[model samples]
Target: MDLDDDILYEDDSGNESSENGDDQFMEMNMEPESSSSQKRDEVDDFQFEILTPDKIVSHMVDCIKEVNAVVEIPATTTRILLNHFRWDKEKLMERYYDGDQDKLFTEAHVISPHRSIVSKPKKTTRQTAAASSAEVTCEICFLSLPSKGLTGLECGHKFCTLCWTEYLTTKIMDEGMGQTISCAAHKCDILVDDATVMSLIRDPRVKLKYQHLITNSFVECNRLMRWCPAPDCGNAVKVAYSDAKPALCSCGHRFCFACGENWHEPVRCVWLKKWIRKCDDDSETSNWIAANTKECPKCRITIEKDGGCNHMICKNQNCKADFCWVCLGPWEPHGSSWYNCNRFDEDDAKKARDNQELSRSMLQRYLFYCNRYMNHMQSLKFEHKLYASIKVKMEEMQQHNMSWIEVQFLHKAVDVLCQCRQTLMFTYVFAFYLKKNNQSIIFEDNQKDLENSTETLSEFLERDITSELLVDIKQKVQDKYRYCESRRKVLLDHVYEGYDKDWWEYIDI
Candidate 1:
């Protein structure tokens, strides 16, 4: 597939509008590709999907299938061989095809019971003898159990089910050694495979834990694979590029495929991580930028804004005074703590918006995204009126009060909500490298207005229905939601217009 397949154009004319930032947007005039062609192109790209439990099992089976096809071995033996190599199919292929077959099998702890005396390798004679033993002592717990109640790895080191259960449970739950748990036999270093571990462990929950650890090891240990860092999201990202760069997961997580951190393109992973920690460390330190740190005018000590209000009262007991959050001026001129001044003047706002070109400081843009992202996220909390509305929608659904999935749009609306928030967050990253010009100015202002309205809407959405201001809040929330969403559309449209029309002369370095 060509780059053009991934990137569509703006318009039929493919023309750039005039210098003025008005009535401009990407047309995306390309004719839609046929479904078959589109699917072919999708396959051409390195595609990744979140594998389900069944899919994971199928993936392992596929590996076994391919390994068997190459080596002509039993699928169970192939599974063990693959696990022994940490699922490195290439190494398994090379070793089995190009290297000594007996060495590979012996190292992997696999022995074919069907092999007769004539077919048995000299190296596997010891394994054959051990498997023929009528009674074996359990290495762990030093207990005598029936041979049928025991399991052994490639090394013929057998352990009773009770001992294996206890060992496996400890490794999975306490030691977190599920991926590296070895045979309990003294001086035996054979790594236990998932099937053997599951067979030995009786508890379904513990077996699941063991399986999860092995599955996670593929992404955790493999160079080409990366697990999404999002909380509770289980996604493995497999990219074609071997270089260190960002990759997006199916779960909406964009992370550095190389470093396993959030996308930080212009900065190195180490510095980015350090910067993130310096800004986000809890218990010891609060996120400086996200928390909006500014010096207290009275105390001259660093303080963070703790509320949505612009009027701030200094927490310093020695210098208890009120001041403006924006300019550090006294709060007295604007009485009743009701004054709004963070809305900077046009000239100051213009300068602040494009300050990235000169200083290359990402502080403002980072803060903007952090605040808006958190605002949208916090708005989704259970206490908010939005959830109440969602509850009503669910009740309507349960009672069959409405037909044709009347509340279906809620899912789409929330999806759009999250999408817009993410676009707003990443737009700043793009803006940080953009030239300070009319385009940047327009986009920045759009962002600022959208953010203001979003916060206002979030505030309104949080208001209790029983409150006297409920009607007013509802009206305000609706108004802000429309305005914010519309502005966001225009902002993204303009950016897409620029990208499609190739508007950038040179990105800011």
Candidate 2:
């Protein structure tokens, strides 16, 4: 099967219109949908797309910034809340609204060191938020310090600046705990967030490492997110729906957003995986001729029954025994061809017959679909060559002052051929695995119509037609393309509907 890289691709003639031959291509219902509108309706509806690592980091920073503003908390406290909520902004709101604010702070492991036990302290205007208060005890170093000696988190843990910095630096740099660090107290379990890491970690390299961890967590923890599978792609995709699906990344890599596998459509993901494993497992032993081997009756040597007559002589001369290849019995009773030996065992003939019939029917059906699918792929390659020739033809006609736009019909025809051929290839895949029922017949009829339309479009694209005929051929191609696309979508929708109804439930095994 020509099931090569199935990613939908374009040869980057960016933004070139199919109807560029003439400003007046032809009167046809060939108005292409706006790409932005299409993306908005289908892809962007999930409020996500693949983004580069830089963009992911930027998004992470923005989320932290937004939480900081709304909660009126320091960035460290905001990050603690965010991490506690698994980076879900809505869940953070839910938790914040679910109970007492103090409870929220306690659960997030944030304690305010500046809390006054007796009464609320008078508002002071002189110092910034990061400034440490004087007269604090440094618990880690057991030092009594004057003012400006210590900073504290909401969790009420306080330590001298030197101790806090060393602890943060050690956790972030040496222990690789930059993603999260707890309070400096030996027994404390309060998890410090990135904001605190930035404040306490003096080294720029450690600060950068902490930032990277916190930023990368945005994609790592979300259910509706994943890093792109392509090597060095460094992009991720997220969507509200977490179902198995193929998505086109911004980096031009098409992949399964769920498992990060290559795009495989028509076949469901589970079924495709089973098929791949089966192929791998049977790769060596599944050869038709090799599988037909038998043992020599006389010497017990393994022998392959390569196609010939039923009569056979043992290759093991030491025990030269003439045995029928079919029955593996002495040749005298089998006579010449031994046609009678080919009969199934009467004792379990019914069971054996049913299995053989089923296997034959399934194999025939698969081959029927696979051959047609491959034929379309081959035809598509030829159509691509035809388009190249059309390009050369247009170049030669440059002296006539006839722009490709005036002959845009020919170009559009080529586009239609490509689109239809691709559709036809996968349509067969969908058909073969589809459940056998009345709908199967209807689906087949639809497929047949699409195949006819595709072939008709292909003929138009390949024809050596006069310049005057370009418009008519173009119009025909456009109409056929639209029809074929409609049919293709209908078939795909049917298969997807089958999946929803549990048509392929056991396919994975």
Candidate 3:
């Protein structure tokens, strides 16, 4: 199935457009409508471009040229200056025209192009040849060779071309550095320009790797670009402004442009990150232990019961106090009772029980949200496989005199279904830490409505269609999916409203 064969574009008016492309790209219409009709959904309406590797390189060159037109410096030097400012052309221009130019060049690790030099007698052709022929020892290899064989940067520290190639290769291949590679001379901070590195490195593999590293550095450092985080995907997204909004990659993987995780709606990036850390940690296991075990009253050592008797002894040799495990009180006070703890009614015992109950309750609450989150995630994974089933259904519908265009609604239904599931999955994470209030109750009600509708829509899609009921099934499926989309939007809009009005209150777990 050649799905995602084109890019999706969502304009400011919430309308969509698609173009046929050589590579796989899927456009997503996942943004929810704003609760207030007076305001536009600006979160996902920002300007951006989906760029391939070649396009990325072309764009970088275009930026350099655009800046070079005004600065009128060597393109190589301009590249160095741009890299210093993280590819922010506006910032670089401001600094260039309004600030100290020499300091700018110095901070970029390049010798100033306008530096003053004392006039000297120009050497003739014969004198130049004689000077080039004079042998000088290479500082690195300590080998004497003709001066023509040695080369260096503007800093005047010379090394053999062979040494320079090896040094650059190590920096490029071993250290995986390209944009920030410095001169190989000791304690020198001047950067080696791209032309110099390209000239020195002869290996095609190293050259390609160096080029890749350079492009990667440009994307990573540029505030306006983000590499699509999908596995094995080489595409990048370029935006006019940086914001925490959904970005659909050409690979059909949707992610948050700001944090690079899957596009999670309702739950902001901060809470999602905290929830992920909580899920990955072993703190829950420790909590379980705290609720189920008791400490030795004497040595403070933890103990778990393996026998029926309530009478217990501290295992520590230095302090073996006989105490009833049930109340953690001295056994001597129990007299001859060997099977029961008379001090179970003590204040300490009551407090300990209350603490254990609180720990257990908190653990159960976390699990409630975690299980729902995981269930939806697992369901979403399997939902992708539905495309194969959907293709078969699409074919079946076409064979039954239905036009190919008409059968596309099945595919659209599955897309909407997957998005609804995704949104429902994150609602649990938002609710888990939410402190109870009227606003939270309303959020949960919205969550419940969406969850119920999504499940019903999923079930409707999985039902087999027969020739007799084909027309009826199509109408039902369309209505169900439209309802699901509406509910999903409602849930999201309410959460967004909460964010704007500061209606959310959270409790620390």
Query: lDDT of each prediction vs. the true structure?
Result: 0.56, 0.61, 0.80
Candidate 1 accuracy as TM-score: 0.48
* Model 1 CA deviation exceeding 4 Å by range: 1-50, 74-77, 80-96, 100-152, 156-165, 194-199, 202-205, 216-278, 282-418, 425-446, 449-509
The sequence of per-residue lDDT tens digits that candidate 1 reaches over residues 1-509 is 11121111112223333422111111111223122311111322534444433344445445555677767754445656777787788987888777467777667665643344556546577766665555766767777665766777756777777777787899898877755676777766666665566445555456556556656665565556566788888656655454555566556666666677765433345544544563465512333332346666566787767788877888788988886766556677656445655543446434533442333334445555456545544644432345547566445444544443554444334444544555555554555456777777877787787666655654554444343443453455455666767877787677767766866443432
Model 3 score (lDDT) = 0.80
Clash numbers, per candidate: 1, 15, 0
Q: TM-score of every model?
A: 0.48, 0.55, 0.83
Q: Write the per-residue lDDT of candidate 2 for residues 411-476, one digit (tens) a residue.
A: 666776776677667666556556667666766787787778777767655666555655565567
**Candidate 1: minimum summed lDDT over ten consecutive residues — where?**
20-29
Which lDDT value does model 1 have at 412? Answer: 39
Ranked candidates, highest lDDT first: 3, 2, 1
Strongest candidate by TM-score: 3
Displacement of the residue 395 alpha carbon in candidate 2, Å: 5.4
